[model samples]
Target chain A: MLYFTAMSDDNTLYEDLLRIRRFEEAVLDNFPKGVFFGTTHTYLGQEANAVGVLDDIHSGDIVFSNHRGHGHFLAYGGDIRSLFAELMGKTTGVCGGRGGSQHLQWQNFYSNGVQGGIIPIATGMALAEKRKYSDAIVIAFMGDGTLGEGVVYEALNMASLWQAPILFVLENNRIAQTTPIEMAVAGDISARFKAFNIMVRELDSSDVKEILPVAAELIAEVRSLKSPRTLILNTYRFGPHSKGDDIRDKHEIDQLRVERDPILIHAHRLDSNHKEAIELKVEKYIQEAFNQALADPLPDASKALTGSINHQ
Target chain B: MPTVLYALNAALQNALASDERVVIMGEDILDPYGGAFKVTRGLSDSFPDRVITTPISEAGIVGIAAGMALRGLLPVVEIMFGDFITLIADQVINHAAKFRWMYNDQVRVPIVIRTPMGGRRGYGPTHSQTMEKFFIGVPGLRVLAPNTFSDPGDLLSKAIFEDNDPVLFIENKLLYLNTIHDSNRLSEFEFFEQTPEPNFYHHSKHNGTIADLSNNYAPTCMLSLRDAPPPVLTIAAYGYISEFAYQAALNLAYEYEVFTELVYPTQLSPCDMGAILSSTKRTGRLLVVEEGTHNLGWGAEVIAQTAENLGSRLLSARRIAALNLPIPASGPLEEAVLPGIEHIIQAAQKMV
Candidate 1:
């Protein structure tokens, strides 16, 4: 029951998960040597949320992500080398080095460093697609930490009233940069969306198999109903908030890694030899991306002076 | 004569009819009510789906508009009042303005935010304000204000269709009722198109030839009393106050014999300083009049730019702007604090 016979190939999903894992591992492992610019939020334990939800993405659909977005970007099929180059502030980067870490844009996938800001934008994009009769739904990802922003509620209200085709994904990592969700969030998170008459679906899982089917159903409902839906994924983050800022107990993190590791949970379903093959391929792929990004030239400093807005 | 409100409404109608990508979103902009200033009157009835009436969330509205613009839609958002723009500053400054540059030209936010600014009504402190100064220097954003000289509709069309950046289109609250002037209406003053060509002013100075109207979207206009003596002072102004500055110029020539020329540029940021500089060089003295507060305002910037360009050639310079104080609800207090035609005249006399 965990795996869907009609769904994506399990090997491909496992490889996708491994790619994010190895890419983030490369980021963390290379951070000490100062190979990257700006801070990064690694998706060590929360890889399943991205790989599972984005499995439902159709062409012309929009995906809006937050600061902790590398996993989501990789799952959305963003170029690994370009993402690496972007983090290194090189010319071959996704945003040509202007948007270092946290800010990335490739095709219909966009990410901003600001929390809760992308929600309204996503709602608007969904509405735009609906107006065009394109039948393209939007998937906007936010964190439990972003619940503190009042604009999220405003966007939810508008989205419900307008019947915008969007799936609101709340990745509840139980922590917001050292602050626990219980301390920061008030009342019930699901009720917040329900208050605006938006359909709510909650899940607590680290396995991509479990998340994939539920996310697919919710995404289908959003597309068919042409209305907003909230999918609150209660998850765990096994890495530092951003480059060695962890304040949680090491023993608790180690215990969570063993019990709630998404990669480990999914690896049990795959053959050992196949898992090793994916690990090796992802390792080589991530290493080549990192090395090529490191070797790429930095963006031309002179072009930074020219105004992006029309100066003529 | 068409009113400024008519021009703006026509612009909206023309944009919606011309392109399906154009959308208008605001609070209470629907039928029967139109907008607060009626600048969006008759738009919703004409294009129901395009003119959207939303909740009272300025930040959310602007944020949504930015999204729509990013996805190949030209969204023209209307903030109920210019004062309410403070609530959406984060969305406009951080998101709309920074998207193009921050994204490294991956996308463009072609949104036109139309809001009524300025005070003459008794709408109190928060309702009436010339707050366009705050958004002037923001990169990847353009600030445009239309006056009586040319068609404001033309400029709005250009902003919505031509420009690939976000434009804050300011419509003065008092100017909504004022009449737009054509060549016949401006017969008392000499009107000439400030051509975009280089050294046109220098050529005009040598030959004394008047240039015909050039088809420019937001060209600056220069005006002086017909057959008057050479200008001794140059006055710079924009938006609703530019009309008063023109009147002050005529008053100075006929009534006081000060002989001043008025330079009004519709585009504020990335301000076209060519006409202002040429007039200042001829006049030797410059005076800037604005309705915004005096500190770090539009007048200060115009003065600063003129001084930077004509350091030694500038004989004298002065800025006439509103007093640095919160606009009071009382009529007399508001009038006393805001810069008026008398202020421009007095400032011109002193500079000359």
Candidate 2:
């Protein structure tokens, strides 16, 4: 069993949250400048969900994320430079630039653009770990939009039926792209999971400190029982679904940003001097990642067809 | 006694018993239920821990199989019907087929997708259809179908252990109950006087004069002749339609005096172009037959490659396949849509 030790001066939690927030902000800033090639679903306001949940992820454990997966990738220790390189379509990227932002795959970390596709894949990975008698669990991260897909339910049923060691983290921001959750989802999400006999734990994503203890407990339960569980993080996305889709009202978005800003809330916990030092360090790190990734050369078009198909 | 269905069961049983990493997952594959087609009967009872009964989720099954394969397990997934393959096409085409190459050859998806295809059961458009054409050109996938000459047991075992790539093992519904008999077996010619001198042309590279004489199941042609004469036309077919091609060859040998050779290729995707080119060079005319619809079908691919390779040496080439339309529920309508032995004979005659 793992326990969270929050010392009075410990800044790891705050730094993790700040790194994702700052990195995504850097990506958004570079988007309009045409530095990054394709669209990226920013994990702007949902940093606590990824940081808090992935705090307990073991080294051997695997993680699968959705389209809005930059934060999950970073929180799980994905290389920031390679991630920026991937967004820029460089050969030094995680997937050698073939897979863009939505399709980032590194060691023990994978993300796909398709909704509900990774749940079953994560469950299978958990099944493999279980069969091998390894204690490593799998964490599959999805948003409220993924609940609309039928494959998620199928995966949930299998995960529960097989008692796979998987922690399904649902970052329920109550919105699916431009559409609100009320317009899309039907009934109680937790009740639906309970019907499948999976244990459900709801966590408030407004504060990383509050999310850490609960996430650690749930992770321990999944690891001990080797059973499927869910941690529904009630959060909100501060930015648009993508770069060019700011359909939400500015007044409402500003209110949520002020009331539930994860970064500010965590920063308030730190001393003034400590917060300043951490922010400066995180900013410099993000800047270096951006500059290094920009300096990297683009992939050669002549060798584009090399790894398209593998033969025996 | 070794029917196609039993041969499949034997192959699956051998895989499960041989490797601890081998696992079977599908809907209704558990014991008592066996499977939709009973190909997995008694498997669960014998290897209870390995054979997993899954929900009716094609995409989930395939996606999970891909994950398992990536994590060092040889997973054999059974998609109950061929038509349902469309449900898992994204996982098959995008994920399973692309994972090895897209991931820079770091992983091997040693997975076998076993599904029953073809339309003769009057099961209607959605259920009964030969949709193997859709998966033919997929780069990383090996699409194969078993015929009379090839044993499903051996083919499936090879797919499981020998190859590191994913294989789409298509089993025809009609051939499930059919017995596996080699026409050239000694028991087949027991009544003949002096063993009825073997009268056929074997490729110099291949030593087998008859299908039964071969020790291994490789892609090869079996020529049926009235006398020791060169074939005028080479009729190539696979899966269920190969039975029709064999019948047409025999009929042409007896009636038209058009000595014909029948080519049955077990592996269809990376088809054995060497043997096919050799046979087509000897017999300048070629007729390709398949149960899939004619428009851009497997037959089209065979003809295209043969024409490109043979060039002027190939005299004429034609293809006989199902009409480009949905299979109907009525027996006669299904028959009308599908290509039969008469269609094969007519197409061969035109080429001759």
Candidate 3:
């Protein structure tokens, strides 16, 4: 079922996973210095979910990401400097600094801060491409917390009934802010998608090698069949939810970090020298992006406040 | 002889036939049912590929339509009842409306959400309510309502094809059966038309003063009675309530010998205040009528805006709106709560 088996031979996937890990670390480290504005959800431990799924995205494929979307944006080949500038609220940032870390729109990729809101939008975009008879598909990323929103089920019903060309990647980190998944979600997650007749694939791994092959198969099947599919990635989050707000036990978090770190799990597959080279390059790249973003000028307050009131 | 419903249907037909990218998505909007209010009649049969009958999910329907709009398609969503707009407020306010500006003009959501608002049919509290007051001041949203006073089809078409923002097209439930009032029919009241430019016409009764401003979008109408002294008060109303306001103006003139100028606006938000201001300035008095409840409603916003601008020149101003209570299901109770032609006439008579 895996179509792009040759992709496993290259070190690009290793670099992609490292890039997200390092970039998020920089965001958390500098957030105390007041370099970024508003709130940000770091994609600390979910690097494989983004790098594995988005590695072989088609040219016209669209990606709809959620609040914790820095990893998805980076894996989509988004410009690192502009993304950093967006977090810094600079005029040269993506979306002109209007959409901060949670809300970003660049090229064919879009992300919103609201949970479960992007599901229907992504389904509709997939339907649009299907109606046009275009070979394009859509990828929508959702979190476990979004399961509480009623609109998610509403969209899933239509996505299956309409047979939209979409791949719904559910990154269930098993915690919603401060509440654990056991306290929130009842029954099973895969059964929710299966009830709508959408085919579901469940994987509980952090290694990019295990995730990439399954994502390639599901993504290819969605394009060829022009129907909706779900990929439930049971993942983990290493950092606090956002800006130091973790209530989980320190020992449990540290234990999971040692066992399920996506970068560390994938690094063992590469040669020692090659892995060190990738790590050094990614560290330098993250630093330069952050420095350039810090130097950029903030948006003009006087002019930025003008256009929204005049709705002509 | 086209009814308001026929005109709205024609607008949808024309837009779907003219552009291949125009899509119609809603519940029960197919050929047999043709939507809850029948505004989308015959559209599904005509454009089979474009017309989509969706599930009974108001929020999901709007979100899907917004996605279609973001990807360069003109999607017109029909929310069966206007009261259900509460479900889709997040999608319209946070997502679709803010997409263009939030994205810094990188994309635009050209969507038209047509819903049947207002209550005269006794559809009860939940089904029969005018809810535009909740969305009047929304920044990136255009709230448009068409009546028999002008061509509803033309206004609907403008929202679908011309505007590049998200539009909430309000169609009053009672107005669907009413026939359009042709401009030439105003001759019965000694009315004369003045076309300052093509597609822009101003009609005024004999001896009534009119504003000189030009509106590029739908223009507001100023209705006054013939053979009466200059208006002592100006009445501002919109949607289905405008019809009753005009009737009250006529009754106030002939029955009570009280003259009042009536101003009806189709565009609720970004309202063209020039016409209302001109009439109010001449009269020195204003009365705003609304079908929705009075407290913090559209009428209050209008009165606030006009008062802020007019200051001391506006000698007196009042609002005639529904009682501050839920619209009862009983016919008599609903009538007792809602404002009607009798209420308007009484208000105008006392104001004068």
Highest-DockQ candidate:
1
TM-score of each: 0.95, 0.90, 0.95
lDDT of 2 by residue, B1-352 (tens): 5899999999999889988889999999999999999999999999999999998899888888887877778899999999999998878887777766565455567789999998999899998899989898887888889876656687888777766677899999999998876555623111111111212322321231211111123345455553447788878888888788878877877788777767777877755555567778999888988998998988888888899999999999998989999999999999999999998777777777
Residue A123, candidate 1: Cα error in Å is: 0.8
What's the CA error at residue B180 for candidate 2, in Å? 3.1
Question: Model 3, which residues run further than 4 Å from truth?
Answer: A5-10, A308-312, B188-216
What is the per-residue lDDT of model 3 for residues B180-231, given as tens digits with 9 covering 90 to 100?
8887787535332221142334332112322111223665777777676888
User: What are the clashing pairs of model 3?
Assistant: none
What TM-score does candidate 2 get on C-alpha atoms? Answer: 0.90
Chain B of candidate 1 vs. true chain B, TM: 0.93
Overall lDDT per candidate, in order of appearance: 0.86, 0.82, 0.86
| Tens digit of per-residue lDDT, candidate 1, span B102-121 | 88887877788989999989
Q: What clash pairs does model 2 have?
A: none
Candidate 2 CAPRI assessment class:
acceptable
Q: What DockQ does model 1 achieve?
A: 0.45
Docking class of 1: acceptable
